[model samples]
Target: MEYTELKVWKETRLLVNNVYDVTKAFPKDETYGLTSQIRRCVVSIPSNIAEGCGRRTPKDSIHFFHISRGSLYELETQLYLALDQNYIQEKEHKVLLDQIIGCKKLLNGFINYYKTLKTKQTINH
Candidate 1:
């Protein structure tokens, strides 16, 4: 299946764009600091998912999914830091947090699905 068709991937793709839009207003001093870090994590979420989908085995796919999930968590922490630094308002933080939470749920579900496939493959062999 195409990674683009996955809900987790679609959600993460939206997140990346949203983050980029929000980060544009960040202080110029952070252009290569927090801003760059945040953007990288956001991009990794969907990029890793696409890479995972291209893997030849469910196990390999899951490794990438875990990496994607890790990036999601990392992004969450960065968003909180943005809030602490006043780079984003509470409302903006909440919106981004909500999106990240939703993506986490979808990504966890996707990972579980892949784990099941790996288990089934092992059982059948």
Candidate 2:
């Protein structure tokens, strides 16, 4: 299946939208600071997933997936920073956290699936 069709990728895409929507209310001064950083981290999640899917080998795919997972964690931290800075409300922060948790679970499963394929390929060879 195309990476875009994957549940994790789809959910991450939604997260990108939700983040963009929320960040719009952030201070104008943060436009190039936290805002930009958050945007990049969120975009990386799905972009890396797509890149991984395009890779020829399972190991190569897993590498990109790992990067995506790392970005998700980074984004999670940034969300907390946003909350502490009062850039977002507790309710909004909770929603984003929940979405991140869901994406993490799905991405972890996807990574494991690739790892199994890698193991099988190694055994077959």
Best by lDDT: 2
Name every residue pair that clashes in candidate 2: none
The reply for model 2, stretches above 4 Å from the true place, is none
Q: Model 2 scores what on Cα lDDT?
A: 0.96
Model 1: how far residue 59 lies from native, Å? 0.5
Q: Model 1, range 1-125, lDDT digits (tens) per residue?
A: 67788888999999999999999999999999999999989999999999999999999999999999999899999999999999999998999999999999999999999999999999999
Off by over 4 Å in 1: none
Best by TM-score: 2
Q: How far in Å is the alpha carbon of 115 misplaced in model 2?
A: 0.5
lDDT of 1 at 97: 93
1-125, model 2: which lDDT tens digit per residue? 77778999999999999999999999999999999999999999999999999999999999999999999999999999999999999999999999999999999999999999999999999
TM-scores of all candidate predictions against the true structure: 0.98, 0.99
The superposed Cα distance between candidate 1 and the true structure at residue 51, in angstroms, equals 0.4
